[model samples]
Target: DHHLNPCYVCNSTGHNCRALPRMRPRIPDDVSPTEITGNGLSETEPPVLEEEMEEPIGVEDTDFVLYVSAVETERCRRGLTVAYASHCQQESALDRPVAGHANFCPGELSTKYRDLPSVLSTVKHEMLHALGFSVSLFAFYRDDNGEPLTERRPDTGNPPLDEELQIHKWSSRVVKNITRKNWMIRGGFMERTFHMIVTPRVVKEVRNHFNCSTLEGAELEDQGGDGTALTHWEKRVFENEAMTGTHTQNSVFSRISFAMM
Candidate 1:
């Protein structure tokens, strides 16, 4: 039998056509009545709403409450502590860290991001980074004599399948538990690593490790922004080839920002 998942936008109304899904605003707890217009001009202050702090749930609005309840239960079961942040406004969405170990902001623990699936995926993604896997974590590896071992190129000489498998094993449990009612996570951590960073080494590593290409090359297109950084045309040629049949070329900004975040 075929089961239907709610459409990303309009919650599968079958008639209500909207450009994007209706997202709940994660307004700051200390909001005043300053109205910010579409043109980004401020007018009057926003009225303060008196409500208890809420938990972060998945972004799909209809399922938000349910997802929150499940998340609370899971957190309880895992003995994970949660906190909230009220300062996360839409305009500053990119500035906040979704959740973290000790310094979690108010509402952050409970604030659903743009969409439920994407936010949950991001949670898992960030958790992996926290557990030590991303570029930040690569600095942790040491040789028997206390020298950095991960600084050298991984043995793509024989393909780093074993290392990739190890990373998958480490992240699988935290990723497996969240039920989205529809969304399911796929792809290994290696794939996520490739998408999250832009570097020649990461590009080559991903290509040799997973036999795939990513948007890292596209970021090379923006050269004049920073005065000192320079990109060579050889990599630019590869970037163009990687994105031959894809959409617009400005996506590198998005990919680079993702890693930086």
Candidate 2:
């Protein structure tokens, strides 16, 4: 899901995906004319009209009304918001030369990205980030005394048996203090502390899934672009894991990623 573009909702801040109702575009009545070409030829079978869908049953009202479009191609489809983008056509829309027409190629994904499953996985990955898989929730995971949100790790060290490690996990309670040991301290004793930015709950989920005690910071140790650095799963540790800054080919959302989302 290595989409360079940030989340359309929340503007790549990556919090509140599933909880956030998608913004229905304030569609303006004045639409630019749509140019059609040979591709608009009538199909052998006429298109199936949309069935009147019932409002989603038993879920929160936020669930969108998905108008199932019976199209043979992805180009005619809409994004997650389910907004209908009716393109208006003015006079002589067909007279324009198809050679220089850019609208014919209007797509965000092409080439290897055109694989439907891969595209869907990438959408899942982005949606996870939008729902706060890794974001500013770090502040919520610290106590007033500036300790991590977890209870004391029993003896402040390892347990005798591997089975005993489960006791070391986080308690149901959550607290945080941003005044000290926050994402700002990037060097010295606090260098690794950057990892705390993703709430300990998520870190705990990640650690438990991998059976690893040590969890660390942003995927890129070096500086990164707007979409990288603080906003991803550790790439080195979770290669091909969907939440990492750079999406891998054929990546699937890992269990830890799903839980955090």
Write model 1 residue lDDT over 1-261, tens digit each, in one string: 011112224333223444432233344545543554543324454433343333334344331111112233333333232321111111112212222231232233545553444334334433433333233222233333544333332432111223432321212211112222433346522211111223334445435444466433312222322211121112333342211111123222222223222
The parts of candidate 2 lying over 4 Å away from their true place are 1-60, 63-108, 111-114, 134-194, 197-200, 214-223
State candidate 1's TM-score: 0.21
lDDT of 2: 0.38
User: How far out, in Å, is residue 147 in model 1?
Assistant: 7.4
The most accurate candidate by lDDT is 2
Clashing pairs in 2: 142-175, 142-176
Model 2 misses residue 220 by how many Å? 7.4
For candidate 1, the clash count comes to 20
**Candidate 2, 61-81: lDDT as tens digits:** 432221223233454243322
Q: What is the C-alpha RMSD, rounded to one decimal, of candidate 1? A: 22.6
TM-score of 2: 0.37
